[model samples]
Target: MYRQILVHPEDRNLQRILWRTSGDEPVKEFQLNTVTYGLSCAPYLAIQTLHQLASDEEDQFPKGAAVIRRDTYVDDILTGADTLEEARDIREQLTHLCAAAQWIEQR
Candidate 1:
């Protein structure tokens, strides 16, 4: 289950998501593409959409694994890092980007 949960409540965009899976199964990979519904002006929807595109952010993962990539009406985000440290770094960068209104948070 990869659901985008809004961390801090605010008029502006601020959020984080969790993706979990089970069973020892072969993960299916795909060339991902993202887009916004272009209806609601809420970060929740955008965050959810990102997960919908790619949401396998589990603990046990391969290195340099760039997971989710969501493209809004005119914006986008790329989450999922190779290592824990890389993921944290990505989160920081994403936080700032969202604050700057670049594309909003998709954690």
Candidate 2:
């Protein structure tokens, strides 16, 4: 999720990822190049991504950011409306908001 947020080029080296497929293989070292899961700061990084996207005025929806900040948890987005049309509209709005941030809605 941290990969979702853009990081400064200067700071990218700080997020270097070093690993190997197997013990017999030589250790490989490379920069993350993007935020990723499991880093100690990943949750904060993901929240930053959400905050940055939600704060954009051009893509703001009625109570949309509030809903995301308050309702979202562990990748689940929980929302509904009194009517199907309203629900669908919210869905579309949310989808557009994510798309604007380069996150394609999967499903």
Candidate 3:
């Protein structure tokens, strides 16, 4: 999720950190220009952003919007279907829906 959502330029200052594995060298300042894994609000914010996107494009992706609103838990998406084809279709729908929402799925 590091590069999925970008950190606003003005807010990048808050995500900065000092790096120095050992005390032998001077510490260096580093800034996170994108959303990273450990931040408290990262997961929630990411999910909420998707939810908002789904809501905004409900007409274009009704099923995807429903899935985003009800089937997701944190970072996991729990969905199923009676047949394998249906399940795969749902998965594909979710994938394309995410792309249509302008979210780049990051592994």
Considering TM-score, where higher is better, how would the candidates rank from best to worst?
A: 3, 2, 1
> How does each model score on TM-score?
0.26, 0.72, 0.74
Backbone steric clashes in candidate 2, count: 2
Summarize candidate 2's per-residue lDDT along 1-107 as a digit string, tens digits: 55566666898889886899999999998886676678777777777667666777334675566666777764568987899988888787777776767642222
TM-score of 1: 0.26
Ranking by lDDT: 3, 2, 1
Q: Which regions of candidate 2 deviate over 4 angstroms?
A: 19-28, 58-60, 103-107
| Cα RMSD (angstroms) for every candidate in the order listed | 17.0, 4.6, 3.7
Q: Pairing residues by index, what is the TM-score of model 2?
A: 0.72
For residues 1-36, could you state the per-residue lDDT of candidate 1 as single tens digits? 112323244422322223436556555443212222
Maximum-TM-score candidate = 3
Clashes of each: 2, 2, 0
TM-score of 3: 0.74
Residue 101 CA displacement from its true place in model 1, Å:
2.1
lDDT per model, in order?
0.40, 0.70, 0.78
Per-residue error at 83 for model 3, in Å? 4.1
**True lDDT of residue 97, candidate 2:** 70
